[model samples]
Target: MDLSALKQLGMDDREINLYLALFQLGPSSIRDIASHTGINRGTTYESLKQMAARGLISYAPKGKRRVFRAEDPDKLLLLAEEKKSALEGTIDSLKTNIIPGLHHLKPDFSAGNVRFYEGDDGIETVLKDILATVGQQTDKEYCVFSTKSIRHHLYRPFPNYTLQRIRRKIKVRVIAVGDGGEDAEYSERKWLKTDGPVDASYIAIYPPKVAMISMASENYPVATVLEAPEVARSQQVVFDALWGFL
Candidate 1:
């Protein structure tokens, strides 16, 4: 797991380090946590203070010093739940503040360029938009290049989608680079095991547009939407060549 991702989960550097140390070491003193986490005494004390306030740790006075120990592991789950509740509350507050202003505003009548989206829901919105595009297609024929090994792991909702598309007469062609390829019951799908580089990035080209998904990269999931007529035409050409080779 990425330390940056953990930080995004509301953990400061020293707090994350100390928490991870406690998780690994079971229960230990602040000095022991500092030794394992490589955090300074002052930082450790501050982190412990914050953790205790968050109901993450407990300590008992022992002679001249206090012996700190991590609380139940379930406290992490509780913390996560609390964070989720707080975020929902914040979103509700923002919507309450902004929705009336939004209602008073007029829609943008001017044309715009590309839009950037963030987070998992944003990614899902992009995917649903692409699927809508495919649904709009008259003689739907789409092809995608992907990794079979990991597609289902991340896209568990995909199978039912393609099945529905197939029912709608949309043709699907997926070329996976490993075993257990694209979903069954989808049309024109095939797999090939290769030593060549194959991973989470996948390219999907439809008649009117081409989309490339960067799924495994550390950055946010992104797909570029191109409207250039010539670009789409050229991509279709390249897609035809690859489709034939596959």
Candidate 2:
């Protein structure tokens, strides 16, 4: 019998064993249940006590001893419902109270902040931060300068990045430095003609912040994120001018 569902409801192995033992033995004493389940008498008594507290088992005093029986199996469904309700409440609190309060504790980035990241995980972090920061803004849009050489490596760490951005209604404008860039929802693309191969680099200007991704030796990915309004505004200006011409 697959009793794994009981474990999901917070029952340990001992509690499950003792609970099942009660159904088979039918109103048995702790000693009898322990003997039948091959569990120690002390452990069996404690487990049964916990099970009874959870409303999975019921006990009745009989002379000097107590006889225990398993409660209706439907109680497991009730327990799962209770857990689901508690989890929903927690998620609500996290969104409304906990998350905003924690954001208040972050250090001010007005003086400018720069961070470096390496490898696939690092690139993913940069992409996630871009979405998070831009998604909260009223405009919900950003600009990108992407080179053909680096475009494929950019989203390797975050394959679902475009899907997530589209879902959040965040828009992006891309200035393709060379050739070859895909069209995506909530995004616009323009090409910049190049005569020769350019370095593998991609830049994102998302107001108040900029992220640059490049390939190191042997195509190893690296990223730099700068949090400075002036720098971002300057890049935005250049991108806008070029976008107008293209």
Candidate whose lDDT is highest = 2
What is the TM-score of each predicted model, taking all chains together?
0.47, 0.79
The residue-level lDDT of candidate 1 at 163 comes to 60
185-237: candidate 1 lDDT, tens digit per residue: 54776665698666666567764566666654554466565544466678778
Q: Write the per-residue lDDT of candidate 2 for residues 142-183, one digit (tens) a residue.
A: 999999999888889899999999999999999999999999
Off by over 4 Å in 2: 110-116, 128-140, 163-169, 207-209, 226-238
lDDT of 2 at 156: 90
Clashes of each: 0, 0
Cα distance off (Å), candidate 1, residue 181: 1.7
